[model samples]
Target chain A: MMKIFGKVAAIVAGSALVATAAFAEDRKSYPAPKDHPLSEIISGYEFRTPETRALQDDDFENPAYILLDLGAELWSTADGAAGKSCASCHGDAAESMKGIGASFPKWSKERNKAITVEQQINICREEQMQADTWKWTKDPNMLGMTIFVKNQSRGMPIVLDNSPEMETVRKLGEEVYYTRYGQLDMSCANCHEDYYGNYIRADMLSQGQINGFPTYRLKWNGVGSTHRRFKGCMKNIRANPFKPQGEEFTALEAYMMYRAVGLPIETPSVRN
Target chain B: MRFAALVLSGVFMASVASAEEIKKVEIVDGAVQASLTGKPGDAVAGAKVFKGRRAGNCLACHGNKDMSGEQFHGETGPIMDGVADRYSTEQLRAIVVNSKKVFGDHTLMPAFYEVDRLSRVAKKFEGKTVLSAQQVEDVVAYLLTLKE
Candidate 1:
């Protein structure tokens, strides 16, 4: 019985160490060579050239810009009984919405749960602006509003509050990252953190950073959101992926943002 | 080695020179065939995909580019240099199509032809493959250019 208790204590202590690590905000910089297998993986990849660098820095006029302008118009034009526009309540997205996207996937102790950016945006529209709840997905007005508004703080550092309530969500994301799923029994850490830079078949393993989000995938044949890309990775693992807009994904985005705190934003990067 | 080359080169010649090369070369499924397509491949475009962000993301795995010991050289597959001497174009095609069919049923090589649906693949790739018919030819063209 005492041995059992000792084992339990060790597990609790191990978990505490991981929890401390989750909040530390800067992992031991990219695993040092000789320590991790991925250290060798990066060396094999043909480093990017000036042309590819240009590809990274090129301007990407959002294909949905027209829709965003329509959203802006909708933001100004009242369509609800309260006669309040979205701009009337939130003011300018750039000025009023600073550090907003970075703080999302936050857990609400009062409500006893975590919330996503998509849900938060709608909550404001429904409660404060007195507007009808925007339908999810196919709603161009909502997609445009969110994208245009989020781009306001394009360079802001992701600053998720390391509150006690967040302990669960961060842990969940970490678990998902390391837990190997699928017929291959390969985990996210195995390919990304562990086998990163290594080849599975032929393609090189990227740093798996979410920094270059909303990237353009030549394979996908168009621009795609980070959530969509993450789902693709999960699918590659042969694991049943969560919906891009689901709560689990929101938590993942939060953890990814936290991990890539200092990395520069590389939106609309052209990927293989 | 000379005998193997003659066989593979002969196989390639018949395939390239005459469309009826299929009858000459033995199609042995469940066995990996590394027949060399004597024709040279395009190193320039191969260089692009090998070094660029577009595709073949070889750099993502193995260190192939010159001038950098930056250490991303992957050990997953044997360093791809002199691949033509090792296997014929048809054999290389099989490896690219599905390395597992030869390397062991369990392989790490992504089925470039099978997954991405590369053009001009076998009946199995009726729907899936990565490279186009021209692109596969180009890769084959480039592979032949790799000689020490």
Candidate 2:
């Protein structure tokens, strides 16, 4: 009787351990907020054509790697009046920048506002390295470096700012996302939220998730930033676009990052 | 030479006047009671405008069962099948001309003939309506053909 009881106890303990492990794994995979509107948070990757998806799967086949290589070079090369490269302060980005990309659009106490990864890079250049800031978007050097840094956090889940300081900015972003603009009289929610899987002409609309930005678009024939894509969308609606480095886009980025929480970073990702 | 100069100025002024004449529309009881062009619309031309990307591009939002041969009908707005059964020609004209005036601000449909009071219109597209008054009439005529 004692031996039978011992065996049953061991079985129960084993099953409980397995259940706990499974729960932890699930949390790690999908750390989405409980109140999120989407029942399932799908990555933009799922919406891409098989060929585009395949390009992202293979590092060599992916055209974004060309830019990433340039970014790697820039990481070690010294520039500006300070005569310092990024490596001078932070050595071996592989170790320091790991998971850095996944955690961005964070609140900056100094700036008194939420800042994106690109903004932070410029800030570091000005304050730390005494260098001139790069253009907000479409600059090849800026694109390469940004993609490189972001690539370090590839496959890591996105982390967003939920602090009290970010509350107003996030609200503003939500408002902008829902507000109708331009001659077309359409909001971001009209297509991205309401009809994500549906086609607007030949193009299939995704949820407009930002986890895969600085994405490699076949249309652009190169890598581009989230803000550039935002500008493109605005133009498509016949609206004059806001600047990439402007406050409106920054707030939008913060809100978008919040929406994309827990999705894996896929910087330099291939898209059509 | 003086006569020729006068004729040239007159011709230029006439062209400008015609360009400015976009046709004033008044909404009465959720419909535009009069024709915009004061002429009958061509349904065939309206169909072409409906399909052309540079023209109405209506298929981008509204699905049409008759246009099944055309790819990628959007679901953002209602399927345009049997749209004629629901609305009259005047009501359709009002909706096509300026949907916001008829359906309020909540509708996603763009005002095809409204050009003023729009925010952040691209420099190139400023003061330009998405569709001409005649085109709107044509689109309305085509829409009227979509019976149950």
Query: Clashing residue pairs in candidate 2, if any?
Result: none
Least accurate 10 contiguous residues by lDDT in model 1 chain A = A39-48
When only the first chain is scored, the TM-scores of the models are 0.69, 0.87
For model 2, how does the per-residue alpha-carbon lDDT over A47-120 read when each residue is reduced to its tens digit?
77889899999999999999999999999999889999999998999899998889777789988988888998
Q: What is the overall TM-score of model 2 with all chains considered together?
A: 0.84
Q: Identify the CAPRI category of the predicted complex in candidate 1.
A: incorrect
lDDT of 2 at A83: 91
Residue lDDT tens for model 2, B1-148 = 9999977885564345335556668888668988898888888988877887767899987779988998888655667888888788988898899877876676677888887768888876677677777778889989999999
Residue range A82-183, candidate 1, lDDT tens digits:
788777877776687666555566786765767765567677777776778875444566655655555555656555667876767766776666664442
What is model 2's DockQ versus the real complex? 0.24
* Regions of model 1 farther than 4 Å from truth: A1-56, A60-81, A129-139, A198-202, A266-272, B1-148
